[model samples]
Target: MQQYAILTYHQIDLAPPPPAQFRSLYVAPSAFARQMACLKALGYRGVSMRELLPYLRGDRVGKVVGLTFDDGYCNNLERALPVLQKCGFTATCYVMSHLLGKTNVWDIENGVTQAALMSAAQIRQWAQAGMEIGAHTQTHCKLPLMADADAMREISDCKAELGALLGEPVEHFCYPYGLYEARHAAMAQAAGYQSATTTQRGKVVVGTDFFQLRRIPVVRSTFMPQFLLKLLTGYENGKGA
Candidate 1:
């Protein structure tokens, strides 16, 4: 069986700024670099969603890994990109369309605080640097709770805008906050995406659902030992979960 892992990261700052909403979610930039170095040292191959299609269908290969960054934070471009470039790994970034030049407003556990999102120009630069950009929806709204028509509009419109901005089709999506239901998957399909990702923790197996691909969340405390376990074993069986 072909096994694939999708790792998720939020901010890559050394320390979360005072009043930073997701202080707990911040991973130091150097820590991210170390994680990438470990992966490279272990001979893991980074595969994008497009490249993973065959593996998803049961095509076997050496250890395969997928890296995904969510929320379109500017640090993704500032911190994560350089580390990824160093390791020669490519990742998919999910951007919230309405928050393009603004900040995320729905910081539930962290209160109603905000954090900077990437600007259109920054997103374009990342695209030019070979990072895949995907839609996280127009407002980062929870899709499962949205009305069908509203959900469709959020998914489709974001893709259209991103496609226009990048001059290419935005073919993948990540659920906001890893929240979604069957209706959400249907809406993503209606939006013309080839695949969609989720916060569900597990290694993607040969027969895993493409529309609701699982991802392993990487946080500040996940050092080399934890990181290697999560990569080799699924998150459900690893320490993070």
Candidate 2:
């Protein structure tokens, strides 16, 4: 089988000092640059979900890695974009339709450090710069906990809302907090999404489920060797549910 590693990232800026929750989610800008450079050096093209679709569908094959940023952060634009452009790569940033220009308020209950999400203009710039913008929902809510009707609306309406913003079809979707159920997968498919990625730890292959496609996360603590292992080998496969 042809396997591809879809690497997940969040913030791409300096990590806040200790005691700030979810520090693992931040990847220092310098480190991110190095990682992208390493991929380029290794002859791998870091691509967006849109570009990786053919490979995932067995239509084409090459050394490509799906680069994705979850919960669209302003730093992703400020810090990650230049590095990606320098590397001649494209990535996907999944933004919450209703939360643009706002902080991650849904994480307040968990005491997670609030970070500014990309504003509407910044999102447009991201798209203008050849990056893909995927939908993360209207609000960053856990789909499995919501009523079915509400969950469906979150799934479908986000695609519509973001499509309107980008003036093109938003073909990708991602579950909030990586918390979803089988029904949510069905909902994503019904929402007209080409694919939906999850927090599941594994590499995707040609036969992998499109809606529940697995991903490998890159975090603050992921050093280069480990990152390469996750990206180039089966180190992360079968590790998460």
Candidate 3:
């Protein structure tokens, strides 16, 4: 079976000094550049979900890794995009439809640092720059914690809203916090997304569930050797299993 690694990233800027929350979510720009350079050096092409779909469905195959950024951090555009372009890679940035141009309010209670999300124009710039924009939801709410109807609306409406904004269908999704149930997967399918990723640690193999696809995370502390292991071997998949 052909296994593919979909890597997850959150913020691609300098991490705040210690005592800030979710510090692991931040990967410094220089580190990110090195990681991408390493991928290129190894002959792997990092791609967006849109670009990876055919491979996931057994329609095509190659040395490809799906690149994804959660929460639509502005830093992704400011810092990550140029590096991705230089490496000739593309990524999917999952944004909250209703929270564009705002901070991550959903994380306020958890003490996560406030950061700017991409605005509509900035998102257009990303798409125009050959990157992809997927939907996280209308507000980045935890899907399983809400009633089915509310959850369904969050899933379906986000696609519609983002599609309208982009003039193209938003064909991918991600579970906020990786917290979701079976019904939420169905909701994602119902919302017309081709795939939905989670925080699950693993590389995707043939016959993996599209709606609940697994991912390998690249965090602040992940060094070059470990990153290569996660991509080139079954390192992370072993952990998830």
Candidate 4:
């Protein structure tokens, strides 16, 4: 039986930033490089969401994994891209349509500094470099708290805009802040996404819900020992602590 893992990341920076939450989620550039290296060394192949669908249907692949980065931080392009490419890995990057070339306000009210997202051009660069780009909604708003119309608009608009930019169908989505519900999943499906990811920690299996796929969040403290455990043991029992 084939099993799959969805790995998630945010900013890649060295040293802890002022915002404690930032440090908890951010994986430094060097550390990311090491992580990818470890995966490659362990014979893991990074597959895209689209590719994994076939595998989920019992089509076999050798040691397959999926990599996803949420929030579309410029650091993903500046730092993580190189490491991924070095390891011959391709990942899904979910970008907030409204935040392209703009600063994210998610952390502003909390007195924590936010990061700028990649521009449309940078997103195109990643596409050209063989990375799959997915929609992270128009404003990175939490979908579960949104009304039905608002949720529909957010998912539909982002997919339309991204498809126009990429000249390809944008079929994947990630719920902002890892927050999603049954309604959000239904909206994503109606909006034309083939699959969507959530922060709910777990390993993806043949019976997993395509629209509510779970991912393991990789953070600053996610070093070699924990990383190895995550891969070897899976995320069935992880609550992200």
Candidate 5:
């Protein structure tokens, strides 16, 4: 009955605050470092989904949790990586393949900052550093709303593109915005991803879905007590409106 958490984050920086619309997702750099350091202090070892896979198969079952960053922000390289390295941890970055080397136009158009994304070279450096690059679909498409065929194409093609770019098997996927349907799971399975994660809040247990896995969303509102409580207990403290 051993359990572990898969933690998800989007951006890492100390920027005062993003436009009100996107504020919840960015964790200040000082806070991010403190968060990781807290885990290290608690004897938790942050691992990539690549490394945490065996444990999900009823093996390992060690004091390890999966770490993931969505959107493949260049800040994940410029800011997050050093914190991870300092804590002796590895992580997975889910990239929107069709948008590599470009700004997050999807969010930019919505009034968020025009954040830069990791280039192919930066992603390669992440891979070389023992991190994993997972697919977040080619255009960050929401598969739940697309036709099955288009959904399949989105699921399969990003795996193909990133695998080709990295020169290695791309085995992990994460649904964009944690939005997906059962059919999307079927599509991802067909695409050959060994595991996929969702934005749902929970810790990984013996019988969690390998393809539609759950993750705890780490955000700016996740202060130390709340962060530690979520990591240790899977119960997120709700913020009031």
Candidate 6:
């Protein structure tokens, strides 16, 4: 069986998080680097979602894993890139299109840290460094409550905007808050995205949904033992999600 773990991440730094949110959203840079090193040591090559498509399609599969970052925080390029480059891997960052060069106001309103997102130039630079840029909507809004046209614009328009910014086709997406319904997938498909990722936790196997793909979350609290469990069994604490 062809299997892969699509690992998802957010801000990756050792800086203390703001007083409001769970620490799980902040995976330490050392831990992030260690995770990548572990994957490589185990003979797994971390790949971008775009690069993992063929393996997902039942072609030949090696020990491959997919790495992704959500919200496109500046630290992704500033901190995660070097670790990834050291690991001989490439990954994708899902950018909130309209929020480039701005702080994460959405998370702030929800009492999370007011972290800075990547500027347009930083995004371009990351892409130039061989990382893939995926769309994460214009405002990082959830899709299920949105009307058809609104959802289409969030999904489709964001893709177009990022493609223009990166000077390449943006063909992957991620639903905000990992919340979605079937209609959202249709919107993503109509937007010309080859695939979309979700927060649903599991190891990806053959026949996984291209649109509603599950991801293994690497977070601050995922220490070595728990991380090993997730990699070995596709679940954390055996919850499977």
Candidate 1: residue 192 Cα off by (Å): 1.2
- Give the clashing residue pairs of candidate 5, or none: none
Worst 10 residues of 5 by lDDT: 232-241
Ranking by lDDT: 2, 3, 6, 5, 4, 1
Q: Against the true structure, what is every candidate's RMSD?
A: 2.3, 0.7, 1.0, 1.7, 2.3, 1.6
Assess the local accuracy of residue 178 in candidate 3 as a C-alpha lDDT between 0 and 100: 91
Model 1 accuracy (lDDT, Cα): 0.82
Q: Write the per-residue lDDT of candidate 6 for residues 75-125, one digit (tens) a residue.
A: 999999999888889999999889999988887666776788999999998
Question: Over 4 Å off in model 4, which ranges?
Answer: 235-241
Tens-place lDDT digits, model 4, residues 51-165: 7677765666568788998888889999988888888888999998888998768777766566778999999998888999999999989788888899889999999999998
Best by lDDT: 2
Best by TM-score: 2
Please report, as a residue range, the 10-residue window in candidate 3 with the lowest summed lDDT. Answer: 232-241
The regions of model 3 sitting more than 4 angstroms off are none
What is the Å distance of residue 74 in model 3 from its true position?
0.5
User: With candidate 5 superimposed using the best TM-score fit, by how many Å does residue 101's alpha carbon deviate from the native?
Assistant: 0.5
lDDT of 2: 0.94
Better of 5 and 6 by TM-score: 6
Best-to-worst ranking by TM-score: 2, 3, 6, 5, 4, 1
Clashing pairs in 6: none
Clashes of each: 0, 0, 0, 0, 0, 0
What lDDT does candidate 2 reach at residue 143? 91
For each candidate, what is the lDDT?
A: 0.82, 0.94, 0.93, 0.84, 0.87, 0.87
Candidate 1 ranges with C-alpha deviation above 4 Å:
17-21, 235-241
